[model samples]
Target: MESLLECIICKEPYNQSNRAPIILTCGHTFCKSCVHKMSQHSQYIRCPIDRKFESRDLSSLNMNYAIVQIQEYERTGILAKERCKAHEFPIVITCKTCNIDCCPKCIRKHLSHDMYDMEHPTLIQELDNSMNGFEIKIKEYLDASFSAKNRLDKEISELDHQKVKLKKEIEDAFESLMRILENKKIQSIQQLDHKIKEKEDFLKQRLNDVNEQIKYYSMHYDEFQHMKKYYKESTFIDRVVSCRNVLRELNFVQFIKPKDINDNKLRIIVDTTPLIAHSIGSVSFNEKSSSEILMEQLNFQIEELKSNKLIYNKTNPEQKLSLEIQSISNFLCMSENIPELAKMHLIECCCNEILGYSSLKLSDHLKQELSKKIDTESLFDTKIQEYIPTLRSKLKYVKGLIYSLEKIHEKEWEKGLYVLHCLIINENEYDFAELYLQIALLRICSQSFYIINQFKVIDALPLVDLIKRYTKFHFLPSTMCYKQVMSSLRFAYKFVENQMPDFFFPYFKTQYSAYLTEMSSKATENIPSEYPSELLAIFQGLDSSDLHFWKDSDLSKQFLNKVHRFKEECSPWFQALRFVQERGEELSDFELAALERSLN
Candidate 1:
């Protein structure tokens, strides 16, 4: 039996000494030495059994370990069957109860038990039939194993080939990109040269024109000197008249030199430092997304598999799917090392485990399966319902985030703002964060304004306290907080004006005064020193109605002072001063007097 497992070419029993047994691509087993000898002629060696070509060489072939184990087991079974342990005589009878064969002399001890006679002709024939059936089953298992392995080997080879092709494609793409950039660089240089040449020509023409004018003037002066020194009175007078007529005939050409076009330095559209950094970062990000890049490669691989008819499903007999046991193994074997692929495999595994099934199901069957997994006790159970209570827990998650940030700020506000800024920026990088912020803001807006309207809810903090919490957390360098928390403040303020007049009015009045102070300081700096006609154009466009809100505070006195200072320094401020002066109804008597004094 062991000799049957020997290599056909080497005629040697499979063992480690002969490099055991290994199967070629053609499903032929051979000792490693024989395969090596065949591979010496070419990498594509023919199988000893089928004369078919094997793409991989001897070293890369998979070991036939099952055959080797079978050979060892057969050799052990032969030795075990050589003699009986119960009786030393030539064993003939078999005791089925003890599972022992014995001589006829020892068989009398087992007469009362269930047993099989080893020497019975019918029993031996039946055993031979059973052995034949076992051989057929073994052959079927072997065929299936070899077929699965062949598909796996082909897939691995294709994956490697795709990797090489994709690498070349990336290299070509970068080379093409470099070529385009080089062309653009040449064009930019040529454009600069053209501009410089144009400027040079203009300067040279002005220089020649100026020199011609100087030469004409010099000749006329020389002629005058000669008349004064040597010419008679009548000749000098006639010459003077002729020269004056000539001078009148000469056209006056004003040569105004062009201002310097630009200093001797390079000017580019945008500083490339940030652009280059962004480009490098984008490349690194693309490299990290290799799985997405390989999606196109996977499509090509699928096409190749279709050509080979290696469809993974089992609706057709050509497909050999052992999904019940090898689904996970098969999935991972083909899938790239990507988290999304792993997640899909996990979802499939969980479904199979929970439902005791695989693949598609009818709607009714799916419902039945889902019913088994769901809790059906109560309609209001949290597992099956939505529960929203009063405002403390309404934005619990957002409130927690604010509280955490406050704790960090207690350590140091600067560091807290830095951490908060980092978090916000990181959140912006993902698509989901915007939705998260929007949902949180919606809940907050609804709850805060709802409480402000009710006023006597008696369950939560005031809108002012919530607004303060939001502002305390809003001290970020980024404008994101202005759009988020400041918008919330606007909503609160809108509600506060009508709902809680005393607290809201006082708070708003103070805030408005501070805002005016800051505006005055900024407007002072931005106002030009020696006001150009451009200031008159700017002042003409200012609408007095826009400043009507300033009447709500006493700070209008200081704001009027700022306008008066501008009016005294520059005449262009006259229109703006008059516009403010005419809004006499909105201004206090002191502010009106100040405006009038400025106009004077």
Candidate 2:
């Protein structure tokens, strides 16, 4: 009877002394004492059913009235002592054979049956142990359910994230391809219109010339008739004799409109295979159909282009601007795993739309707004530190957009670069002293170079100042930083040497070149010979064969130390070095020279 009203977690009966039953956040009921014990173990009580974080304090839990009612019903049985229903006597022993509770009087009727002594202390102890074991099994099942829920929820969240990212990538790629097609379409239509307008103007001029000649002949014929009717025969003959020279000189060349030459007319022959292949191509509209139906639809569209009553469901520029703003803002909310290809493609699409707004002074407005948001004084204020990370991420996004615009758009290139220069200078004010921030600045400078070279134009003074600020103040010559510095310098050299030769000396190109050479020699000293060609290109301008340049540099001792250290390491190259050192006596002079050079 006591087993029927116990807490599953503690296997203690629900009673006034044990504090009855209390419901947990997991919807399982336990005694108040057990809940307090759980709270003492951890700051939070994990729900056994789902592992959800729950309050540890027992005061917030509700009392289980259902368990109270069940306890009351069990307690009120047969006047405080359960008795046999059939015999109307106090129950003493339970018959094992008949599976019934019985009294001493009832046992006379069941003398042949086996029985259990209900008063046996060992049997009561065994029952208590069984109840305790059942409680443990119930807790185990709850824990297993909680773990499964956790794993499933995580998988569900990750899958949803991936689905969103994949959809976005598909949209971005198609948006770029659509822009390319629209530009091509506009170009083709403009060329066709120009050619047709030329022909139409020529025809109009010819028709006006023909009309003037007809009027000239009509006036002369009318004058000739009037002379015959109003003057003497001699006068008429004299006039005719005088006009004969004019009439003989009169020559009319008929102007016939030229036949439509099919070659001159635009005959759009679209290749349908590329569309089926789902790839980029010159053709836009294509169909796999019978020739008759294709021509009918084509002719209909050609006529439709001339119609003035057409309704255009075009998006307004303001609406497009808003949509683009939202799209770019989505980048900030994205937490992880954005592919570089997708980033470039999406930015290019946005830049294509932004090109139409060059007259609006959008870049200047954006720069002012961003700088205001990231004011130097506010960043140092005590209250704004928590919001610093969000502001930094948004600023980084803006810098990325500007870099992309400089690469892809022409008219906006100068404006974007100017804005980016301001942003880099602004960033320096806040994070100049930090090493990681300086590393980021180096990468920004590196990215800026490709765009500058691509457009073949720059505000050379600002660019030079920006580069000097990063490299001079924050010079950390690690492998990655070295590559970035050398690349930018190479682009800077090309930009000066080819495009702006006159701007070279005043902008410190010579000094920068020397700095790049030093960095290259240091950066490439420890690099293996099998490193990528891109890495090798950074050292291209710095002569690898210049023994004096390498030997005289400050990094030469460090390089020598590294070479010796490499020889001692356990690697394939080190094994080869070890073999050569072991067999030094057998090597010829040329072979020995080659081995020595390999270490250098």
Predictions in order: lDDT: 0.45, 0.47
lDDT by residue (92-174, candidate 1, tens digit) is 66777787777777778888876776768777887899999999999999998997787567657756986898888878878
lDDT of 2 by residue, 1-600 (tens): 566478767787876445557777677777777867777888887655567767646666766666666665676842334545464355888777887878889989778898778877766886789898998998998898887787567557755975798678777778888888788778767976877778777667766776777776677667666655545556465666656654454434243444445555344444556655866544343443222332344234223322311211144322222222333222222322232222222222323232222112235544343224333222112232233343343334333333423332333333333333334443332321132233333334434454455544344334544444444433333334434444445654655465655654534565555556554442322211131243224333333122112112233333333323322421323343334446543234344334333433
* Candidate 1: Cα lDDT at 543: 43
Which window of ten consecutive residues has the lowest lDDT sum in model 1?
383-392
Off by over 4 Å in 2: 1-90, 103-109, 119-140, 159-237, 243-247, 250-600
Most accurate candidate by lDDT: 2
Which predicted model would earn the best TM-score?
2
- Residue 222, candidate 1: C-alpha displacement in angstroms: 9.8
